[model samples]
Target: MSDLLRLLPWSGPDGRRCYVSADSGGGPVSRLADRLEELQLDTGAELLDHVEELLRAHRVSGDELRFCVHRLAEALRDALRVAESRGRRIPVPEDEMEDEMEGHPEPPGLC
Candidate 1:
C-alpha cells in the first residue's frame, strides 16, 4: 500500500527477516500477514495484563519470574515488529513538509 519497502509479518526459512514489494496490499499473502499482525498485537496485550497481575502477587519464585521474563521478551519483539511495519506505511503530509521548508516549523509559540 506504500511506495516504501514493506516488511511482512513472518521470517524466512533461515529465520531472516522477510519483506514484500509495494502493492495494493489486497493479496492473499498480504491479508494473511495483516491478520497475523493483529493476532501478535493481541497476544502482546494479553501478555502485558498477565504480567501486571503476576507482579502484583507477593509470592513470585525465580522460576516464575524467569518464565515471565522470557514471555515478555517475546511479546516485546512482536510489538516492535508490528510498530515498524505500521509506521513505514504512514504517509508524511505534503503540507507539513512544505511548512518545514518555509522555516515555520510551528506557528508562533505553538512549539
Candidate 2:
C-alpha cells in the first residue's frame, strides 16, 4: 500500500468509511472516485434548486415535505462525505492544525 491514503467515495457493505492507497491519482479506482465525487456535487447543486422551488410553493403537501426532507438528508450525506474527503487532502500547517484542534475539544461525529 502507498503512503497516500484516499477516502473512497462509497462506503463498505457495512456502511463504514473506506480508504484506498494510490500514490498517483490516475489509477482506475481514483478515476472512478473522482467521477463519483463530481456526480455527487452536481446532484447536490440540483437538489438545492429543487428544494428552493418546493419550499416556495403556496401549498405544500406533507408527503411532499417528507420526500423533500429525505432527499435533502441523502444529499447532505453525500456533500459531507465529499467535503471530508477533499478536506483531508488539503495541506495544513502544524501551528494552524494545533489552533484548530484547540478550538474543538473533540472531533465531530458524522451524525
Candidate 3:
C-alpha cells in the first residue's frame, strides 16, 4: 500500500534507494510465519499475541498491520543474512539487532 511506503524511512545503498516489498493484501505476516515454522523457529501463538499488541498500540488497522508485519518479516530476513555472513547459525539472537527488529515506537499520540 502507498500509505505503508510513505511511512517507511528510505535509505540509499550503493547509490540506490532500498525499500522493502509491499504486501497490499497484508499476506507477508502469514508467509513469514510459515517460513519460520518450516525452519523450526518460534512462530508460536505467543509471538502473534505480541504482534497484536503492537498493532493495537500503534493504532494500526488491518491493512496497516500488514505493513508492520511485513517490516518484521524483513527484519528477520536481515537478521538471518547477518548470521549467514558471519558463518554462524541462521536466526542467531543478537541483542541490539533484536531491538531494531522489534521496530520503532509508535509515533506520538498513536496510543
- lDDT values of the candidates? 0.76, 0.79, 0.44
Tens digit of lDDT per residue, candidate 3, span 1-111?
A: 321211112225543333232333246643453364344334434455678788679766787678668756855654554343223212435695468548666322200
- Candidate 2 residues 1-111, lDDT tens each? 434467778988777777766465788988999999999989988998988997887588999889989988988998898898888778678798778667655332221
Ranking by TM-score: 2, 1, 3
- TM-score for each of the candidates: 0.77, 0.77, 0.29
Better of 1 and 3 by lDDT: 1
lDDT of 2 at 24: 53
How good is model 3 by TM-score? 0.29
Residue pairs whose backbone atoms clash in candidate 2 = none
Clashes of each: 0, 0, 0
RMSD of each: 8.9, 4.9, 19.5
Which pairs of residues collide in candidate 3?
A: none
- CA error at residue 106 for candidate 1, angstroms: 32
